[model samples]
Structure formats: structure tokens, C-alpha cells
Target: MNLNELRDRAYKTACDHGFHDEELSNEHCLCLVISELMEAVEADRKGRFAKVPVDKKDTIFDERTFHYQNKYFAENFEAYIKDCVEDELADAAIRLLDLCGLRKIDIEDFTEEMLYGAEESCNDETFTESVYAISTIPIRYEYEYDYPLGGQLNSMLLAIFGLAKHLDIDLIWHINQKMRYNDLRENKHGKKY
Candidate 1:
């Protein structure tokens, strides 16, 4: 699915699981996304990434292999996807997508080239620095009344995609998996959010 469709799907999953019982401000939503990014940083520092067995890596996310036991509960489970870098990045992106859906931020006109440009335009900063950049994007929203929140979110998303690309993470797959995982979770995904 394209970003818009993913946004819808993410938001729907969140709503079904009770994340939208009350409206949240732009700041609150952006903070949640930032929180996920911080989690990604923590995961990275600890050397936890989303690796499957070398043999099954390519097909690990396939429908038949998408079970939690295979993805996160297997023998080497802790060494892989549970709150790993890739998973947390997916969570960050999912949180951003969820916000887009809630705010009705229609990014249908945002082309792949636009995303490419956003990524290319970024400074060659460290991953943590890039996360810092993303964190700063939304803060400007509060002070810049004329600027659209969608623009900030789009920039934030590009940084996310860029980091995923740099780290060679199959972010889309993780997002799909996390969304499914979230679906099976309790209200508000068992969090107070």
C-alpha cells in the first residue's frame, strides 16, 4: 500500500484498539512519534535489529511465516524483532501515519521524487542526529502558525524512510507486521495512550 493507504490502515487499527477515544493535539501526536524514534535509538545502541535466520530472511515476512512465534518468539527471539531497531522505526513511522490519518492529512500529491528530494536534502548526520532532526521538525509547527502540520509530518516521514534505507531495513514489512500485532492487542494496545 501507498503511504495514504497505510495511514488509513494504521489509523483504523489504532481506533479499533482504542487509541482515538479522545482527540490529541499536534504536539501530543508528534511526541508519540518521537518517543518511538527514541526507542529505535535505544534498540540500535544495544545491537538489536530485525534479523531472521539467514536462510529464511527473504521469506520471513511472508503470510505463512508471519506468526509471532516465527517473528518474535522463536529460539533467538530476543536477538531479533522484539523492540529492535527496525521494529521501533516501523513503530515511529506507524505513529506518524496514524497521525496523518487522524488529521486528514492528504498526501496523495506527495510524489516519490518529493520523498527522494527530502532524503537527499538532509545533512549526512548520524542516525541519532537524524532523529534529532525529525524531533525538531514538529516543534516548529507550534510556533509557525502559517505552516502546515502535514509538511512537517512529511519531512519527518522522509527522514524515517531515509534512515530505513540507510540501515537496509524492510520498513514496510515491519509496519504491516506491527499493525497486525497491534490489532491483536488490547485497548490502546494495552497502554494508557
Candidate 2:
């Protein structure tokens, strides 16, 4: 329910998946998960489990997305960005818990009162240089021992995968299933959502 509990669930899931290596970074694992998700998205498009597109990279930190997220919208956007990131993070957390034999209800119990915050500082004249911030600092520091944003993202992702495991769905597997749904399939205008 807390960060430490979440971390324990995540670490155990990683170990169960055979991710053994002291030097292996959380960044590395997060990258792997994102890569897997992207690949799964592509594979679904092809109607089979294939490789991910070489070009689809992490746009979360992309220059343009960051530019907009930090610019004039800094004040108003902080909440939106935080919400989006949290959804992704929470989904990741749920997935990880699922993998660890935990149920969705269990995760809901933890999330009930999670305190999340968002702040921003911008300086770029052209883009309104701003820092779009969203965090649960207490939870982040308690689990990772560092304030790095990547840790928060990874912890959330681990939980997500764990949740997926419980539902007998790999991240990619679920994406593929979504692709089959008319509401989710790309309709030439881009993804349905």
C-alpha cells in the first residue's frame, strides 16, 4: 500500500522474471518494459507478436512534448501531465501487483489515499521553459533511496506488469487485445485513444 510495499512487490516480480544482476539498472528495466510495450503495439498492428518499431521511442521526454508540457501550459498543464503520468504509473503498479499474486482490490486499497503533487518552473522564452512536475515524494524516496524521476516511473511500471501477470495478460498481450477492439484500433486518424 505504501512505497516500500510497492517496492517489495516490484523487486519480487523482477526476481521471479529472472532479472538477476546487481548492476542492472531500474532505467534498464523500464526501458525494456517500454520497448516491450511499443513492440506489442506494433505486433498487434501486424496481427502477430513481432518486433517493435525501430523508430517509436519514448516520447514522454521528447523535446516537443516536453516543450509543450512546460511552456505556457505549465500551471494548468501540471495537473494534466501529472494525472496522465500517474495513470501510466498506477497502471504499471497494478500490473506488477497482479504478477505478484495480488488482486486489483488490494492495489485499490493502496491507492485510495496516495498523495500526488505537481509543480513547474519554466524559463525558455520561446517555449516558456518550464518544469512540469508530478510526484509522490515520500513514496519515491522511501522505495528508491534516490529522487530520480526514473525510479518513480520504474516502480510504477513494475506494479503494472505485476498486475498484468495476475490477469494472465502480458503488457503486449493486452495491447494486442485492445488493437482488436474497434474503439481502440487505429482509424487512419491515429489511434482511437
Best-matching candidate per lDDT: 1
TM-score of each: 0.83, 0.28
CA lDDT, every model vs. true structure: 0.77, 0.34
Poorest stretch of ten by lDDT in candidate 2: 125-134
The reply for model 2, stretches above 4 Å from the true place, is 1-7, 47-147, 150-193
Listed per model in order, the count of residue pairs whose N, CA or C atoms clash below 3 Å is 0, 24
- Evaluated against the true structure, the overall lDDT of model 2 is 0.34
lDDT of 2 by residue, 68-122 (tens): 3344434323343222322233333433432332221223332312221111111
Off by over 4 Å in 1: 53-60, 67-79, 108-112, 118-123, 141-146
lDDT of 2 at 67: 39
Error of 1 at 119 (Å): 4.1
Best by TM-score: 1
